[model samples]
Target: MASREFKDHYREQRIFVNRTIAAVLVVFMMICVLAARYYYLQVVQHDVFSTLSDRNRMQLQPITPTRGLIYDRNGVLLADNQPTFSLTIVKERVSDMEETLTSLSDLIEITPEDLASFEKRLYQRRRSYESVTLKTRLTEDEIARIAVNRHLLSGVEVEAELIRYYPQGEDFAHMLGYVGRISEQELKNVDPANYSGTQYYGKLGVEGHYEELLHGKAGFQTVETDVRGRVLRVLEKVAPAPGADISLHIDTELQKVAVQALGERKGAVVAIDPSTGGILALVSTPSFDPNLFVTGIDTASYQALQSSPAIPLFNRALRGQYPPGSTIKPFIGLAGLDTEKVNTGTTVWDPGYYQLKGDDRKYRDWKRQGHGWVDLKAAIAESCDVYFYDLGYRMGVDPMFDYMYRFGFGQLTAYDIDNAREGILPSKEWKRGMKGLPWFPGDSINMSIGQGFMLTTPLQLATGAAVLANRGKWVAPRLIRTINEVEVTDVPSPEDVKVNQEWYWDYIIKAMEEVMHGRHGTARGSARGAEYRMAGKTGTAQVIGIKQGERYDADAIAEEYRDHGLYIGFAPVNNPRIALAVVVENGGGGSSAAAPVARKVFDAYLVGSTQLQAAN
Candidate 1:
């Protein structure tokens, strides 16, 4: 109202026109900016957004390969596979982990142990979107229950998987071993990609040795999944390759015989085919059922095995380190002949005991009143310790250690034998290093008798006997005969023992034969009425050391403190076929306790062969 008096009509018209032009220009710029943004989002970043959208529905899943089958030489199925259903959960698909587990418990029996194990693996290293097992071996009723409540539960599914099953149960557990849940420590070592969907792997024995060959390649499938993580339909599929089937050198017939021979006693027995250097039988008594360990063993059960007085978990054939006792006499005899320390005519007078020149300690023999005049042959045949005691004292510890090491003692016997122990072969240097003491002549005497620090496994003794049977030709022992029906005898070239005289082999072998056939032979009772000739040696090792003058009375001491009986033998002395080593824990004597087991094994294997040849 105040400016009305000075009104300029032309100027106002110009101002109105300028304002309309500026408004139109601003509207045009805003429309261009919006159009450019729309184009960039739709055309340039199209694939990126499409992938994010597809991720909500599509998923990649891993397929576990079929594990290999295990068999004995006679085509007996040792390890098998059975279909099983397990409760599994994918954490990413779940909303509340605690709530889901609680709800699942209402649907099925979720044991405290199950919840604990699931919680433990919740944070373990795993592939993206991989399912964690909550419980295994779901029953049919549980499956039905889960299906009925599927709509309410998220990230839960019943997965069908193949579980390891043992057809022979406990008979071949230690040899074949069992698969178990992947431990957290083991997970750190294995390739995560290779074990994508796999839960169990070999934990011991042959299974562990051949894990790569047994666990086949993993495959994958791209599939459409629902919001709850249930597979709707497969978009793409890649089938996994099955593992190779393997056949071991073990004979089911011979293995059974070995187990039966041991009876209820806790012992170990190993039998080898001298010709092929094949392991025919391996037996460890008080064996546990392998199936119990395949899928995670419970804490209580595991603790029981770990705490048992018998130590059933231990693999004695490959790992038990015990004194060879008098069974080493034959090998000592061979060492003596090879070293020129003693010959066939070399004889030592035994007046019940042996004595070092300056020492008053009496190293007594099995016979209180020993053989009056004992040569190398009589020494071996009668298991005379006094005669060898003098020979070993003269030969010294290092010399015997070298010879014994060559026979696979104090060293792993075979390349493929998993965890085969290298038993102790005591020497002057060993005594100083291990015990911080100088070697003495009495120490040599004890070493000669396979006592003191000298130790050997049953497998080593059997391997040694096989070498003797082969007449110094060494063939590295093998467990597997074939893989996928193809020969897998990947044995290294053996170093055949070349002695000073080839006749030395025959002389020692002949002396061993007398131990089974001669009237005064230590193992004569066990070899009575044998159709074919055989060579053998007996051994008895003390569990508790006897004092300098104390005589061992088995009746007075506890049974657990009794001597461990041992024997090494082979059948058909001239054309040796089967060589074996037997160890009977807490057994009174080798001749009575261990030799009989070897005899039965020999009769079963050799007699069957004889009958088969006659029939053919």
Candidate 2:
């Protein structure tokens, strides 16, 4: 309908004005809503949004500190760090792990062991977004291949890191130990924050004993990154503190000489500096290269080491327990003299065999016809079994056990070395506990001869010899000479083995001298042409027991069943400088097999010390 009147036209104009006002109001409300939303985002949650945005472009990375240097006493490097490249993978960045691994294999030679080790680390508890090492010690060609195929590999990165290297190789394998990748069990015990950037840890020997001082503190750096997660620029940085430098008391030249002396023999040698109680040389023959273990030994090589009959990986010097045999005669003689069970003039008549009061079992002596009318000195020098048999029978087991215990037998030496075994020192109570058997007279006799139910480690033997050399002073053996130019002086000292007569030590020392220089001495042949006077004792440990009426036939028995030869000695009787113990597995005689080895060690240490003193 058309409103022709003036009032109707005015109403239409009013209606048009109202419609315009409504449209304007609607526009103004929408503007207000938009302004409120902007204010909420920019002001209310501004800090939270800003932080999230920055996180996408910035990252915190851990910096591994340099592992400390290891050196011999003379500054020869033992353990070192070498720059090497490794292939790493970030799980979060990879879409398909298996597919990515397969693709990466084409670019680099990825072994099955690498994949297995990577998969093992993948399931282990680790930080999110952290990269995992897939293959370590990457070659230059492999690194170039990966760099060329960078676009094809999304989660992969070629990272450079320091790897552990052993310069001395097998020479210090057991003593220096070797570092390897952090084990799952070790990771559980280590501090997560401190070990975040660290990979390897000490597995054995001194390296294991000083792991804390060797593994340095970890540092961190804040860096700017692009959308692709590549570092753009450094924002802030914190430098890590390097590990403390360690210096061992080991002499490299002496170690070489000892190894050379033990050539072609399956045995162990341990030499110590008597004055400072520092370990000079520790050699276990048929040693394997520790470098192989550091970079992860291959399955075949590791299996070969584990399965070999020679057992090259065994740390015989620290862990092997052998029957002490006749090498214990000097200590037993001292025990006899100290206890007054026998005096210097006391004598025993031997007829090649000994018998207990009523027992018909005749214990045969090593000599078919024994040394007649032997005194304490002659018994020790001649290695007369019958003389000790009578003395041991008279002293019984308790006194012998007490005396041997004072000499550090049957218990851990408590030395600075790791994994030092406490060899068996049989006692009445021990027998009851171990074998559920009562103490017998035959057991005492056997023990006095250092046979049957009694055992000792080469370290224990050497330490015992050092105690004798020190004239009853108990100085614990140590490996670390100093740390970072500061001498290590907190070594524990055991109480002295006080004797009723101090001169008894001199008497025993004089008798030991005879074992090397005397015309009738057991080891006199090996001690020939020596420029310096030395005190020594030789031992033959029986491997197989003969029947009551049968004689030992080495030719009839297997080589493994042959007797183990042992020798213990200290140099320059007037002023002792070195004490040593040598054990040759399946070697026939102590004088022929083990004593010759000691002669070489003595020559090396004594002569070398003189030369060193002259040079200084």
Candidate 3:
């Protein structure tokens, strides 16, 4: 029995020895594999491994710079950046997102918009580890509440964002424009790299015109973070460069004066410094607060603005096209004299109406009882329709069209602003092309009186008046005096577009002076008692067609169907300093309504009557 036990024990020991040998072999092979991997990573694949390690541990972040401020000519801040609080979400750090969001909402009030906005941002961002904005312009109370409950919430954070705020608000809204959040369309159009750190861009006017110069370059920083996506420390930072400053040519004081002067009246007044094409004051009535458009405008509010009868959203000063009425008479008078159709000594007989040979339609004169016989200077001074009718027949439509084109009529003024419409300058060819109709003699007669297919913008009229005042020199109108801190010099005078004899300019200017100073002058009512000579023309354009035999009267017509008062003029007959144009929609009598507005603008501009209620 003892011998058998010994043999069994010996066999068990042999089996144990073989198993131990196999286990040792496996352990040696595992160590060899680990050693080989270490050699490959540390030596052969050093760069690849190092890069992966760095990416896992380090982060790159953008540092947005402060946007430059904007100020008016008088140093009043037009656009400014104010600190605002916004709630953001860090996607990667979030666990149980619904629970986290619920906890956050409990702390701070989150609207349906907040949740909708968050979902939009989540889909827009590619990286789950990245953070996006959930809400903007959070109230102070909301911020404090969120901060207190921050410990309960994960992946939620508050950030300070510089938001654009207009202190003047609605006052200079159209002129200054406003900035807003960039849209998808804009993202496609703009350089994503350049606008990476920029949240807002200028949309129109001065803001849009200088977007590139105002939007500074973006910068980045290296940061270290943990696996949970928590930034531990900033490794290296590159400070961002700020945008350049822009100074406008507009004077705030003048703008305010003009805005107030145009109170309650649906009209436009554009006044400029004649020496330079610097737009001193541009007023378009019923202007809305541009701030409303900066942030997303609500549907109700947008609809209200759009539906408003006053059309507060329209930029009438830069865009409104209207028949210049009789305002172009002075130019036509000049045209007539320049063409030698009517010299200074030329005279015409007026029998209260004008007839074209056999045409029974009497082109009636404004003065029903005509001033029997009048010279060219007297005719312009009195706004004699019959006198101009004769000149129109003699000068022909082609010559008149060519002359007016030189005066910037029916053409865009090439102002340093966008969206200026080129008012129509009708010709035989233009009529045939645009209206698909043959030119008529009656069209020529109407065109001669600044009517028919001819049209002009308020800006164009003001600029044309300036050119006349400057003695045949057209200066491109401008709203911004300087850009990117670089001062813009006076625009060079346009090459003289000869319309008439050089000596004829003197006769026309003298006659225009007489229109303001002469007893029979139609605009004499408003022109009287001016400190300096203001050569001007007053026009009452018929909004509704007058019957062949019916005389137009404001008291007899519906308020909406009444005539529109129009005035175009320049100050100081000899050394013209300011040129202006005023249009009052449905306001009767150019002398009583529109001329006074022009007088007020001229007074405020040239004589410095910033505060005055002079005779209307």
Candidate 4:
């Protein structure tokens, strides 16, 4: 029995040993297979794995430049860039954008317009990257609400973006213009490589003209990220170059005052430094806020602006072409003196109307009881149509064209800013070329009196008046005083601009001075309280053809048929600093309607605010 038990125990030990060896072999084979697979992934497929790792662990982000600031002559901020929170979406991370957007809409009131705008931006930005601008300029309350619900909206993100802010708002609309998003058309125009991170461009006025100077170079950065595409840390970065700040020649205070001075009237006022050609104020009434246009104006709003009867979108300062009316008389009188077509003492008999040789078109005088036997000085004072009518016929077309060209008429001022319309300086050649008709003697007669095909923009008139103030010296119309404290470059030399003659200008200046200081001067009553002598001309452009028996009275005529009042002047008569042009559409007389505006401008420029306060 003992021997049998010993044998059984030895057999059991052998069986246990065999089972232990088999289990160890099985574990060894499994380890070998896992090790081989690991080797294959780590070494043979290293590049693919490395690429996947980079996709999860690295990111590239754009660093946008700060937009340049705009300041007026007084250092008041006009256009500024402010930081604001915008909602964005990362398309790759978004599982269901419609659901995410729907939930986001609950946090903040989202209009169909907002959704439409967002979708447009999304398509433009594409899905591989973050798409901006679901909601912009979010309020504090909205931001708080979004933050609380951020976990619920997986793909939604709140990011900081720069937005354009026009602090002065509607005050500097035309001059400051506005900045807006870069459109596909604008993108095509811009070099994609250069503007990789830039988002806005100037749309008009000074802003549009200096887009390159205002939009600075872009920048970039390489960042390390986690597996979930979260930025971990910056690996490399290049700082963006900031945009150049711009200082305009515009005076915001004077601009404000001028716009206010217009009240509800539709008109335009342009004032420039006669010596330097710096525009002090350019006001076009019925203006709109430029900020409204910064983020792509809606079709309805844009249509309203376009269709408004006041034509707010029309740049009257640069493009409104109207017969200069009596404003052309001073220049015409000067032309006569320069061409030796008429002397200062030259006289023409006026019985309230004038008639050409065979043409029965009686060019009637504004004064039914005309000034009899009027000289050049007397004619300018009374604005005697008969006197100018006689002189214009004698001066003829070619000579008048040459002399008018000297006064910056019928030509674009070519001011530093673009979009200035060259007003019609209707010459015999121009009439013949454009209309394909021979120049008529009657056309010259009418043009001489600032009528019939003779048109001048507000800018052109301001420049011409400045030329007269400069005594035929340097006068180039300027809108930008400095670009980032750097004086504007390549300003045209005043000495380069050719004028009639020095003696002629002297005589004309004396005559214009008399128009304000002279006892019989038309603008004399308007100049009574001014501390300084103002050389000016009063003009009333006839809006309708009058019958031989009709008398013009603004109250009697329809509003559309009423006369346009115009005034062009320079202050302190002898040595002028500020030259201005004012136009009041359908505002009856230049002396009554336009001269006061010029006087106020003169008060702002020649007589400083301190002086006005002291006097007050």
Candidate 5:
């Protein structure tokens, strides 16, 4: 038995065979597992893996559409798009932001303001991968320098883009407004999908009012990029739809004439086409260049504009609320005729002042020795305050408010542009609401002369004059004449201001005509040597309150406190074509300062029309 156990070679061979079988089974199991994983990755999840890989190498980039071109009615370019270079940075790609900014500062002339603005925008940015503009309107030399050092500067890029440009500069600043870097608030309001690549947005005027139409639909492109996120090639692209080119009712020639006419003065002039209610010219002097605002205006420049006494940024035409003065006389006269409170033949005795039934307060007239015994026609033509004061007392505040409201007063007249003020047409209700006081007979007296609580913007006055010129047919004023070659006819129609006597319009219009052509016309000097007949009314709005029986002494008052000169007029009285309103801030009188401005605008339009007619 011992000899048998020592020689057991078969047993050893059996053990070796079992070990070999176990090793083979383990190797086969591992191979099957590896094959299953390969199948899952290559076939089952192919699309998922492919997308992840593509995301790493390819980028979907937004292509900004070119902003619309703005042109005057005569095809004069007001706003245009110009090619500009901008330096941008992506925070995610950058190794160190401060280091990158420092390096860029060394390469280019980066002001402290630029750095501050950039840092602000960097914090405000939505994403780390999105490029933030560091500096705009980069020079050629700056671009070349950045390109040479591109390898060292990781997230920095110089991109060429189209920026808004105002060719008319300061002249059209307020009317066309200006585009500026999108603010944090603006970003919240804007459609992220549409404005992904757009950096600038309209801040004011027509630019703001028609921002949707001006900012075209954005497009996209698939770009092949390297590991460093540098674009290697544009794999596919979808061209962006350019913004609609807009044509305004503004006549550049007329605008220039109006601007020139208002030279060196703090004033506003608004001219409209009576037939179409198209704004021909809108001028607010002491204007600053809109170009300054396009690419983030520097603090110093902005401060200068903000702090200047002239108020260059103020849109006086649409926002300045001043007493209508004598300008509202014609409208008041219309109201009188409509209510039967006073007819065309109604007369009142004038002794240079008006008293409300035994009250000591004597509302003085512009003429110290007023036109003796004035009727409605002579009252408006001579601007006799006594007659209107009596008229206002008779009609009271309710009827006056009603009639004025009908003429687009105490409300927005031009719906086309944004920020137009609805001037105050002081009524008993308005006085109670605003000043918390009862409407007195004296209040009515003041309202009658276009004084106490009676306010009107230059735009409103022009719109009212147009209404009068159109013989009570109201047409809301508009700036946009056409959009993308299609004429815009969606302007709001005027409400019918019906009167008891239809001939009342003609009667008041004839009285206004006398104010321009009659011997005793208030604006007689302004109408001298006119080619065609014009209807007009002169006004002097007091800047400061005058005491009872106290004469308005211009020399005693501060320059800013001097009376504002105002005039409302329409040319070719028989068939009115142009209706205009002029206001000179701190000007001594309407006839001297404001009427001349109206004359210049009238001459430019009427003479130009005559020339065009002869040419045809």
Candidate 6:
């Protein structure tokens, strides 16, 4: 009241007008700020937001490429790709993983094992949105059932993928190992981007060795999806590149024959072309079906294989290590000649046993009543243990190792023979280093006959045989003749074995020929009536060492503990075509068990029954 009494009307009005103007300006500033923000969002950052929205609306899917076909040299299919339906769950797309897994069980037969494997994959999974396989190799009826219930299934997909198949399952099981789901451990070693959409990878054998060439680049597809992340329709696609179709040097018919020849017996046979250095036939018995592992083997079946006494999973040809026995005699004989320790006229008095000049301990020959007098030729033909014993003792361990190594012993033999063992060629340094003991003279004597620490794979034996067939020339043994229809040209050439005297080759070969053709040859029985002149050496290796005064009766011992029969040979002594090695486990004699198999293999290749057709 007091203030009103003294107030001027114009002044009060002016103050009210000023406050109203201040309010108006504040509102205008806010409007400007809002307009600026709207302009920036709509125009400047437009592409970024739109792209993010599209990413949510359209999903990128993976298109697995069709796996490459694997064929034998004769155009016979070894590995193939088959169309199979798999019921899979994308964890991020699924509303509830466990519930969907249960729901899918109703449409098809889902065993407890399937659930267990699914859980294992989840634990091993690396990336998100990756499909978890619930059931694979689905039947047509099961696929139809899943398709009919598609609307109810949110994250589940019925993907038809090309899986690895082996028509020649048993024959090529170990040769071309099957693909399997990539494990976390395996995934770590691979390029994650390349393996994206590809669930399986090469697990073992040739498949494992050439995984890079066999597994092609994965492709991408832009797919439209609903709000629930369900794929609606494909918008765009990048086609997957299929893996290379490779042709192995494996001769299909010869492989079949080798398998048939080895039937039910646990062993290995490897045949090679001496001129080409191509592995004509590589066979290992007690083989499994490669198809069994293609779709992930069942637990019971896998366990059965694991528990099998025969070890069907083992690759005997390339991996099995056994005492080479008399198969090594020819190499040692050659060493003797080259070192000038012995000559063509070299003769040894064999009274069925050998001894050090001062020691009395007898190293007995195979024949108790031994050949009285054996020269180089007779020694090799008769497989005279005493003669080799004498030769080896004089040659010493160093020269033996050097000579054997030149023939590809104690080392891997081939450029393409993957995972093959190099076998043991014992020497003074090796014995001192590995066994922490001095090399005994007795070790030399034993190694001379391919005993003691000496060991060899069937493959190495075959390679050595081929080298011998080549007359001191070295040709690297290999399984791959061509890749993707192109000849494998990158393989390294091995230097020919050094020979001081070139004639030494012919002399050693003549002795080997005598083993198959001579009257008292050990393998004469196996070589009877052969159309072509052949050269061979038979071997009998003891599994368990026989103590002094103890005798080895093959029938008296356990089958696994008996001798391993081995044979190395080549046909048509002059122009050797096929060189091979055969091993028969617990078999009595090389002539009876392994040599006959070699003879059969030689005849199969030389008889001209199966011709090599132009590789398709």
Best by lDDT: 5
Clashing pairs for model 1 are none
Instruction: Summing lDDT over every window of 10 consecutive residues in candidate 2, give the lowest-scoring window.
Output: 607-616
Give the winner by lDDT: 2 or 3: 2
Minimal lDDT window, size 10, model 5:
607-616
lDDT of 5 by residue, 1-616 (tens): 5555376789889999999999998998888888899999999999999998998888888888889999988788999999989999988889898898899889999998888888888888463367989999998899999999999999889988889999899889989999998888898998887888788999999999999899999888899989889999999999888889999989887898899999999999999998888898999998989999898999999999999999999999999999989999998898888888887678999988877767787888888987789899999999999999999989999988988888888898686889989888888777899899999988888888889888999999998899989988888899999999799988877697788888888888899999988999988999999999999999999889988768889998789999999999998998888999999999889999999999999988888665423321
lDDT score for residue 37 of model 6: 90
Clashing pairs in 5: none
The TM-score values for the models, in the order shown, are 0.94, 0.94, 0.89, 0.88, 0.94, 0.93
Q: Write the per-residue lDDT of candidate 2 for residues 1-616, one digit (tens) a residue.
A: 9867456888899999999999999999999998999999899989989998888887777788888888888888989999998899988778889889888887778899888888887777666667889999888899889999988888789999988898888888988888888888998998887787677888999888888888889898888977667789999999888888998878888898888888878899998877888888899988989888876888999999999888998988888899999999999999999899999899999999999889999998999787889999999999999999999999999989998899888887655677778889999999999999999999989998899999898888998899999998987888898889799988887787888999999998888899999999989988899889999999999988988878788899988899999999999888998999999999888999999999988888777676543322
* C-alpha RMSD of candidate 1: 2.6
Residues 333-427 of candidate 4: C-alpha lDDT, one tens digit per residue: 87788778888778899998899878777888888877899888788877888988888899888877876787788776556677778889888
Residues 131-215, candidate 3: write the lDDT tens digits.
Answer: 6777788998999888887776677888888888888776687777778766667767877666665567788777777777677
How do these models rank on TM-score, best leading?
1, 5, 2, 6, 3, 4
lDDT of 3: 0.78
| lDDT, candidates in the order shown | 0.88, 0.88, 0.78, 0.80, 0.89, 0.87
Q: Using alpha carbons, what is the TM-score of model 5? A: 0.94
**What is the lDDT, from 0 to 100, of the residue 298 in candidate 1?**
82
| Model 1 lDDT at residue 387 | 93
Query: In model 3, which residue pairs have backbone atoms overlapping below 3 Å?
Result: none
